[model samples]
Target: MTTFDKVVELLVDAKDCEKDSIKLESTWADLSLDSLDTVELVMNLEDEFGIQLEMNESLKTVGDVVRAIDEGLEQK
Candidate 1:
């Protein structure tokens, strides 16, 4: 699967959201991801992608998460 797909899966799995319900441009708020869910999502994403996201690296939106995954994949 593509990095985007994997990222989406992480979000979907964490939030119990349907795959079709999430889009790349969908914001965290729009996705109804609570603070705890966001933290879990980030940690799961880091493990899935083998990249560590710093605590200060805020992922305020889905786009931000997608971009981070893209960059992380590039680094790998």
Candidate 2:
């Protein structure tokens, strides 16, 4: 599966959301993801992708996460 697909799966599992409800461009606000859920999702992503997420860095959107993963893949 693609990174975006993995992200969707992570979010859906973390939030108990339906697959159809998750979209790559969807904002956290749109997904109604709480702060704790966001943290959990980020952690899951890090674990699944084998990439470290900087806690100090700001990630405001799903697209931002996708871009980060894409960059990480390039490094691998």
Candidate 3:
């Protein structure tokens, strides 16, 4: 699957959300994800993609997470 698809899957699993509901512009708040949820998601993404992802205020949307993962994978 693509990076965006993988990120969407992770979020869907974590938040029990519908797959179609997740979009690139969807924010953490839109998914009802709190700090812990965001941290866990990052850790999961790191493990899944074999990259180090730092959770920060800059990561405001699912697209940001996908971009971070894509960049990390490119560096690999």
Candidate 4:
């Protein structure tokens, strides 16, 4: 699976939500993800992608997380 697909799967499993509900435009708040969840998601992403993400406040959307991981992968 692509990085985007993997990220979506992670989020879906983490939030206990349907895969169809996840979209690029979907925000953490929209997905009912709290601060703790966000941290856990970040950790999961780091482990899955084997990259350390510099936490940023601007990462509020699914697309942001995908882009961050994609960029991190490129750097690797």
Q: Who wins the lDDT comparison?
A: 4
Which RMSD does model 2 reach against the true structure? 1.7
When summed lDDT is taken over every stretch of 10 residues in candidate 3, the lowest stretch is 9-18
TM-score of each: 0.81, 0.82, 0.93, 0.94
lDDT of 4: 0.89
Q: Cα deviation in Å at residue 25, candidate 3?
A: 0.3
Candidate 3 stretches with Cα past 4 Å from truth are none
Which clashing pairs does model 1 show? none
Per-candidate clashes, comma-separated: 0, 0, 0, 0
Q: Write the per-residue lDDT of candidate 2 for residues 1-76, one digit (tens) a residue.
A: 8888888878777787778977767777888887777788888888888887754346767777888888877887
Encode model 3's per-residue lDDT on 1-76: one tens digit a residue.
8999888887777768789889999998888888898898999999999999888988999999999888899999
- Give the TM-score ranking, best first: 4, 3, 2, 1
How much is 75 displaced in model 2, in angstroms? 1.8
* lDDT score of residue 51 within candidate 3: 94
- Candidate 1 on 1-76: residue-level lDDT in tens? 8777877777666678879978877877788877878888888888877887753446777778878778877888
| Ranking, lDDT, top scorer first | 4, 3, 2, 1
Point out the higher-scoring one by lDDT: 1 or 4: 4
- Candidate 4 C-alpha error for residue 1, in Å: 1.5
Q: Note each model's CA RMSD in angstroms.
A: 1.7, 1.7, 0.9, 0.9
Which sections of candidate 1 miss by over 4 Å?
A: 55-58
| Greater-lDDT candidate between 2 and 3 | 3
Q: In terms of TM-score, how similar is model 4 to the real structure?
A: 0.94
